[model samples]
Target: MLKIQNLHKSYSTPQGPLPVLQGIDLNVARGSSLALMGESGSGKSTLLHLIAGLDQADSGSIQVAGQDLGQLSESQLAGWRRSGIGLIFQQFNLISSLSVADNLAFQARLAGRHDRHWQAELTQRLGLTQLLERYPEQLSGGQQQRVALGRALAARPALVLADEPTGSLDEASSNEVLQLLLELLDEQATTLLMVTHSPRVAARLQRRVTLSNGRLAPADGL
Candidate 1:
């Protein structure tokens, strides 16, 4: 569902250009999960941002779900960001003012893909049925992460992009959330591309790749 070839991205700095991703090449099959591992400042997040259409690549092609992201206009990319991909961040970026129910439905509603029945099932399966009316602050870290997961998958997006999803959680909570996420993905037909630094987390995925020195280290980059 995703293909990257010779992808390159750089940033403007006082020290001229600082390259983040250099000649990255990756391919992910549909309905499969991949773990992106790298050290701090290894450009893992930079590559993800490019794939998410939140940032543009300096040179290279990124084709996702058969659409060339580089060829998309800003408005088209914005629309794609809304419907084509599901994003789960480490911080769980839930709307502070919205209830759990509203937060789960927010992106799905915006994408015109909201399904009440599906959400009903999701909440039950996610153990979020009793917390529908609760606000973000009312929930624990695990609960909030579950809500974030639900919100991301509610739309049945073509691809799920998660950046350090379990980074903030304790090991046990992270394991629980990761297992829940994998089970949900198994039940659905979407693809997952997750960025995680933990080997335990990476091992749970179908495939793993690591970035080193602005490039995919061939040893583990697959």
Candidate 2:
């Protein structure tokens, strides 16, 4: 579902240009999940942002679901991201004023693929049945994360990009959330590219890759 070739990115600093990703190449098959592991400043998140069309790469290409992201204009990319991709962040970026149910259905509605049946199923499966009427501030971190997950998957997006999704939860909660996420993704046949710092987390995915010094490498021997 995702392909990258010769991808490069850099940022301007007072000192000079600082390279984040250098000539990165990666390919992820549809319905497959891959873990991206790296140290801080290794460009894991940068790659994710580029793929999501949140940021432009300095050079090279990113293709998701056969669409070349670099070719799309800003408006086209925004529309594509709304319908084609699901994003989960560590911060649980839910609307403070929206209730759990509203938050869950937000993305699906925006994507114009909202199905009441599917949303209800997701609510039940994610254990958010009773929390529907409550706002995000009323829930605990794990509960909020579940809501975020539900929101992302409620749209049945073709590709899911998660950035340290479980980073804010306790160990037990993290494990539970990750397992649930993997199970749902598998059921939906969605492709996943997750960035995580934990080795244990990376080991759970079908494939793993690591970034080091702005370069991509297999995690096999890391």
Tens-digit lDDT string for candidate 1 (1-222): 999999989999998999888899999999999999989999989899999999999999999989999999999999999999999999999999999999999889989999999999989988999999999999999999999999999998989999999999999999999999999987887899999999899999989988998888633544
Q: What TM-score would every model get versus the actual structure?
A: 0.97, 0.98
Q: Among these predicted structures, which one has the highest TM-score?
A: 2
Tell me, by lDDT, which candidate is best. Answer: 2
Candidates' C-alpha lDDT: 0.93, 0.95
Off by over 4 Å in 1: 218-222
Residue-level lDDT of model 2, residues 164-207, one tens digit each, is 99999999999999999999999999999999999899999999
